[model samples]
Target: MSQGNYRVAIDIGTTKVCTIIVRKRADHRVEVCGISIVPCDGMSKGMVAESASVTVAIKESVEAAAADAGVEVNAVYTGLTGSHIESKNRWANVPRSEGMRPVTDLDLSAAKKAAGAIDLPDDRRLLHVIPRSYALDGLHGVRNPLGMHTGELHIESHVITGSISKITKLHNAVFDAGVRVSSMVVEPLASADAVLTADEREEGAVLVDVGGGTSDIAVYHDGSVVHTAVIPVGGFQFSNDLSIAFAIDFESAERLKIKHGTAAPELAGMKEEITLHPTTMSQPLTISKREIGQVLKERTSELFRMIQLKLEEPHLADIPTDRIVFTGGGAKLDGFLNIAKYIFQRKVRLASPRGLDGMPEGTNDPAYSAAVGIALWGMRNLPAENHVDERKISHTSENSGTATLANKQTAGALSMIRGWLPKRDKETAGT
Candidate 1:
């Protein structure tokens, strides 16, 4: 936490790279100073398949953001996602001292260890172990039991886990970009931090981040992230479908999907058509817009169905219905909300990153939500006393000279995990 006021956050997605800079004011309000987005290459489904290429992409994006913000950033909080991430729920109980004394730090530590002792895959590692609620004796839902008196204490928690390899790759990629990796936050979790309100988390909510190669879902109930998963399908799949259906190159198909695709074909007139330039064919072809919509509908509906099925898991089914918030690039597709409503059988709305000042209007798009959220996350999580000396940070084209900053900072992780815990009502606290 160098007395530096600015923090940087980066989201390296499969299809796009985003960087954002935020300045924390004296009053604790965070302002966005700059943002940059670049089409991603050398990445697939949130994994760095080509490390050098990703390093270059990161370097370019970060430099652009630095220019816009009028300051250089030497370290950043990065976002990670993929199909390998998994989550689970567990509980722990601690007995009070023989005299039924108040809880102590030792008791809390024991509870955390108990909750984290659940079985996990050999190849995975725990990313977050978030406490949801604590019970003292028979009284449940106690938010802060630190000073409470009880014969016994019970804790329920959610544990989020991810592949160690994926995390390593993310770190290496950022390191190669000539910047220190301050933290590695799951993409959906970062997005939730930026967009979802505390009320939404407490009331029960789901955040769906639809990116190019994956759609990450985070379910929050009682102010804790109870479940998180990544579906290996996204906007890129739609583009691939269009390419195969229209006999066009992948680039052309992507352009067509972005410019002309829709989720509902029935809305288009039967006689309506659009001109398409198929790469294999020398002549321009006229295709039915409804036909394009039909293909998109098939794929997008399948995605929605998968999301529904994931939610139907017995453990997550209890979450309330009114708080499903959709964000990310795919959420911007035409008629996506209506399609989501039809499939999810619940109220749905688009969530954009907001509440920050000085961001370009283009940065307000849902496509940039994760990026903006990452920046805000950096602002809140990065230590206020840690600052990178701009003079020491080299602007050289090569990444070989950047020193990896060993981050011993723990505040960001605590704040992120705390945000997921249930909040106590004033009346209940008073009582």
Candidate 2:
């Protein structure tokens, strides 16, 4: 909880908004110090439907974490994902001037910028431009072309784009909550950072993060990202399916999904039953666990089938699916691994954050994986913006008041946020 050694990140999900505060240890490693979750309003499928309501929810989540960490939070790093998110691979080759023999940061920057010149609608904006690899002077797949003598340079990049309106709504909500976003990470990349192992990323891996409203797909091979996608279906759909099938309310369906649903109904005991309290005009209904599993199985299977079709896209070119990791709220379903194994037909592992400290026991669930990933990503990349105490800010703005919206002019602000702060060896530092 020491002020100088802390960083915080927030995940604005459809089901809830979660804030996590992490503290760097004496050894320079990080540990969880504070964690907060609040019900989200005015958000659906990762878009802000109402800035006013979302702003209040953002404040509630941040303040809860601040209170737990005993330090105020003034800025946070957040991530975005929705069906509107799309991706493509781009290549840019630029010729250098006569005197400009060696590649420079400016050249690299220009090359990256060139890759985004592809046509797009005015309502859309670039979300991220990740360099898959660089080539200098005819050498291919160069990790860094810095200071290399070359008449030309080329870059293979992964470009992600989304609706400008959706991003601006998110920005306004956080801003009106009185915090500036240091940066924005795409949800799949953030989760991959937190859950995917170096070996997996290097040898070819895929991360499927099925949250309340969207399922994000990211594929990596040769130590770089190759494909990314957002599927419109996710855990929320399963809950809705159960709601209609059992004649129960949405909240009750969600609870039923969490408590008894399974992806493989054939494995469930047929006689085990769950009681559903009836509404005003009906008698209580008793549904068998086998039936619950059957309903969930049909829906979850369809979702995975949809994911399969996405992976089979021609542009993906069959990147290594040798390893697949599952995270997020839906991954908790019983018999999930079996279903995923059958659908993905690969080695599948259920994953969450691995090396965190100070978190409450059993609080480490698939649902919170992306939130933890956001904190890890921010602490590694973004500078810690100085914290301002709650006392100095006005309670008037904190109230349910209307906010004037503001938007930053450039799209590259997010593209430039990827840099790891150097860390000294923890054990050797204090010695």
Candidate 3:
């Protein structure tokens, strides 16, 4: 019920919009206070197709969540994904003028800033500059260089960028809905944060979040993200394939897919048949369970091949991770893992949202992983921004004891705003 304790997240997907409000507990786990999922047709393949419709859906979803939580919603951490999303590793070196001094926090910050200063094309916007690792004076793979004596510090970072036009469209849509975007979270990162285990990340793993319109991929090793990508295929394509193959309406096909679809036909009663009475058909029609599975199987195989191709792309093939975790609605089909295992020939498992408390019944499925992850990301990272801002203000006020009255008033106003909405972290600029 308190303003500073609540964090809201809005995950705008191709098929649905999900808004969740959570409260941070004293134990550091987030408790879901309110959640809303609304059907949306305003987006296609993660991009806004109809801005007005997306705005209306965002407003409706936020209002419903706020009402359920009995709180006012003003800002949110929203998730972003699409084919336009791109990421690459960059490096930067910082030389300390204080010869061979212990590495300070300021040096690390400088390295990160330098690494993130890569020239981006005018059409692209930077989303996040995640620190991958640190190295000092000819040493590589140093986890933390702080307090270590070094004359020069080096930083490896992963820079995420997206199409400027697409990013602007999503931002405008959220703004038009009467809420400020506290941060724009990369969907794969959020999902990984929610579902991946600490061991998985440290030991190397891959997370595939197959959403309604796109499948997001993130590869992790050494406890940091090494590669990330988005494939332009998802649950929508599977259902559409069924619709086209069975000569049924989209809605009917969607229902049928959910009820009986499988990625492996032989495992799911290949000989069994089910009857359907579609709204478009006056008479009942007999549908084979195997046929449905066959259609999905082809698509599933193609998807796996696409994923393999993505992994095998230049600079991505040698990342050295065979463990793959699948999440999101698209991965919920029956026998989905069977096909993935057969195709990837690697360790594959389904993962759901973890590390949160008070999850509502039926909301712990993979479908809500990204939404839950966004809330968790906000809870973990947004507070750090506020802490940093407060530290800066305190240091300034302490150093300059003769602070003007206007400066004090401005600081007070900023403190009040920080209570409602934490400042965005500089490391995650534009997000």
lDDT, residue 347, model 2: 97
lDDT string for model 1 (1-431, tens) is 22366678888987667787766656667666556665567777767778887888799888876665546778888888888888888778764466677888888888878778777777898877778888888798887789778887888888888888888887898898889987777887788887888988888889999887788888887877878889977777887788778877676777677778888777767668889777777999788878889889998889988888888888876778466899988778887887888877777889888857655544567877788777666565445533244553333322221121101112222232223211111111100
**TM-score, predicted candidate 2 vs. hidden true structure:** 0.84
Q: Which of the numbered candidates is closest to the native, going by highest lDDT?
A: 3
Candidates' RMSD to native: 10.9, 11.7, 10.7
Ranking by TM-score: 3, 1, 2
Those runs of model 2 whose alpha carbons end farther than 4 Å from true positions after fitting are 1-5, 99-102, 116-119, 383-431
lDDT of 2: 0.74
Each model's lDDT comes to 0.73, 0.74, 0.79
Clashing pairs in 2: 27-426
Superposed model 3: Cα runs more than 4 Å off = 1-3, 383-431
Q: How does residue 79 of candidate 2 score in lDDT?
A: 82
Query: Per-residue lDDT tens digits of candidate 3, residues 1-431?
Result: 12356678989988778888776655566666667776677888777888998899899888876655545777888999999999998888775685788888888878878888888899998899899888887789998888999777888899999998999999999999999887999999999999999988998898999987889999998898999999978888888888778777777877888888998899877679989988888999998899899999999999999989878867666666789999998999999999899889899999999977756555678988999999887777655322111221221222122223223323432333223211111121110
Q: List where candidate 1 sits over 4 angstroms from the true fold.
A: 94-97, 104-110, 117-119, 378-387, 390-431
295 Cα displacement, candidate 2 (Å)? 1.0
